[model samples]
Target: MQIIIVGCGKVGSTLAEQLSREDNDVTVLDINGQRVEQLVNELDIMGYIGSGISFDTLMEAGVKKADLLIAVTGSDELNLMCCLIAKKAGDCLTIARVRNPEYSRETEFLKKELGLAMVINPELTAAGEAARVLRLPTAISVEVFAKGKVEVLKFRIKPDSPLCRMEIQEIGPKLKSDILVCVVERGGEIIIPNGTFVLQERDNVYVAGAQKKRRNFLSVSASAPDR
Candidate 1:
């Protein structure tokens, strides 16, 4: 995939490095010549020194041939402009990092009006994730995907829990829940669980399912006392 990253700050540089590592052709741009040079040297990815919103700069960055454009400049408005211009100049998928609280409520509006593929607000997302984890005390962490409809939750198994001695295949029938046990972390080893895999106490389990279903499953798995 050909990806153009606008800005040479932490986010942009990190994206460029990760994308390049994944075998994508990544080009990074920024007004700061030094930052661009550092990224190009460190990541071995292409770099351009110029404002992202400039038409000539984007053209020089090969936006026309880019599969995607990501804008993470310090200024929220600048990032938006970068994405908008990239969309018009290249017709590529655009993702903008808009972090201002003032624009938080308008993210949906911006996405629709600007035809943006995604609008990311890192602070807002982190706060939401932290809140989700706090709400689910049994969960070590909570991650949402598929537009928040699906969730992956990590929680530890307790000694007295029914799940401790249960096989992966028995969870659905015994617990009467639809959640899938996707991964298990036991004794510092990560395992992709199969039906015959018997869960042990102190194991960290990662489960994925719809919100309501997973909550129901967790309630049963974590809230029960010893028989």
Candidate 2:
């Protein structure tokens, strides 16, 4: 995809590098000439030094022919303006990085009004991730799906865990819960365990199911005495 990223800061540069690695034609724009030069030197991508909201700068960055325009400028308003201009000037998808908490609440409204493809609030996303991890303290990571109705949790089995020697088939019945063990990482190997597959100590497990059921399972697991 031919993409134009407006902002050469950490987030912008990281996006450019990743997209470039995936063979996307990426062009980054920023007011800082040195940052642009640094990214251009480090990555196989183009860098332009200019304000993201400037029509001429965006045109010069080939926004007309681009497949996507990502506005990640420091200012939320500037990011929105960049996306608005991109929509009016080109038939491309626009994504804006909006960090302001106030603006984050109206993301859907802003997308509808400005025709943005996505509005990403990194701070809000990070907070949500942290909250999910905190809710399940034993989980290394937690991901929600199905409109937050389903959860996928990653956790490791301790050496003294009752689940250490349990077979996959026994988990649901023993815990009196319904959940799917999706993946198991043991001894640096990944396995999609079947019913007969046995869990071991230090095995990192990924489980997915309805959010309530998963929480129930976790609650029981946390209170289970080592046997």
- Clash pairs, model 2 backbone: none
Instruction: Give lDDT: candidate 2, residue 154.
Output: 84
Q: Give the TM-score of candidate 2.
A: 0.90
Q: What TM-score would every model get versus the actual structure? A: 0.78, 0.90
Question: Would you list the clashing residue pairs of candidate 1?
Answer: none
Put down candidate 2 lDDT per residue, 1-227, tens digits, no spaces: 99999998889988998999999999999999999999999995798999988999989999899999999988999999999999998999999999999998898999999999999988888999989977777777887887577778988887766687899999988989899999999889999999999998878889998777888887776533222
lDDT of 2 at 184: 96
lDDT for 170 (candidate 1): 95
**Local distance difference test, candidate 1:** 0.89
